[model samples]
Target: MTFGEKLQKLRKEAGLSQEEFADQMGVSRQAVSKWERDSGYPETEKIIRMGRIFHVTLDYLLNEGEGQSEDLAEGKNEEKGMYVSRETADGFLAFRQRKSLRTGLAWGLISGGLCLSIWWTEPGMILYLVLMIVSVVLLFSVKLADNPYRRIEKEPLVFDEQVKADLNAAFSERKKTAYLLRLTGIVLIAAGILICPLITTWVPLVDDIIFAAGLAAAGVGIFLCIYMTGILRAYRLLMRQETE
Candidate 1:
């Protein structure tokens, strides 16, 4: 008998329907159906699991049948668990890398533009307005970008230990840079807060040029912090800490 036929016979003898068998195997019912119909075969791991369920040896289930032992391990069918492939993981990282820059810039522009527009420069206000509009649009676009891994959000992801290790290493590589940018951002913000007020207190007059310049510097610092954080968040998503 073929592997599927043998599987069907074993499941029937055990008084299990396709759905029950699928549940026992930690797979979808359709996956069980495909197996029984010989349209698909389970992975080598799944085959081993099934052997245990039926109280049969791997040699017995796979014995001398069409030279199929090697072919059976090719997991062409999707399992119940979200088994994330390396390619998918890489694609997601690339997508996030591309999107996060735009996202960070958008937030930076919004904050900086609003702060710089405080002094109400006539022609400069026009420039800030354009930036603000563009920032808002970019933010929305990032939010609505097409995401292929959306379903992964609903389930716990399963991946090879190597994928996990690689992600951890990548995050480690990025953490130092992100930390520096965040520290710099804190310094710049502090300067922005104190730069104008300190001068104003001494002179009893404030310079719009100085205040706007300080806020603008703070904005560039904000951009760096946001950009670095956004990149790290992508690593977190793949690591399965939390979803987006």
Candidate 2:
């Protein structure tokens, strides 16, 4: 079918008049009419917007046969939380990698600065040990944060009941993970604070170590909380899309 035919079909399916569709697309009615008549094409960005608005692929709007294959594949993968194409997966992966790298660097700086501060005051071996533990936890967060879209893609979308339940379960699990990490950090901090005075009397080195460990734990905990919160928000958006 021609692009015009596809445009009309989608517009009708959406139960939108030309004026209404134009309003939704933020374009003039004449522009929508032109598109429906195949007199002109939308700009690249508008094409993407139209595809999303119509629940169709760009290829389909462009009259490319590949869109049918993609649509079929997308339908199958909807239940599996996968994308229709490798390009989509790769694009998401690249975005996640960039975000993860930035997060890792930021955490590294904070953790490094804390360790350096402690070391400067005194040569405390325990400070290094505590930083090491914190580093490990941050590493885990980095790994998990890198692919925040994984759960969204893997969720089943067949029945509304099942889909809603799965989304809720995933969101709750994410929240639980964040809470546990934060609780662990708080406990470590309290323990360190209580032990600091005792360690100071025993040896200066012990005091510094305890202080460094506490700071590291707190820093990592804060980072995890922020990271998980962002993921939860993203999941909400995905759920919205699924429902829409």
TM-scores for all candidates: the values are: 0.61, 0.42
Model 1: CA > 4 A from native? 1-80, 115-121, 201-206, 241-244
Model 1 TM-score, 2 decimals: 0.61
Winning model by TM-score: 1
Tens-digit lDDT string for candidate 2 (29-65):
8998998888988899777656655556566677544
Per-residue CA lDDT of model 1 for 180-201, tens digit only, reads: 8878977777787676545553
lDDT of 1: 0.70
Clashing pairs in 1: none
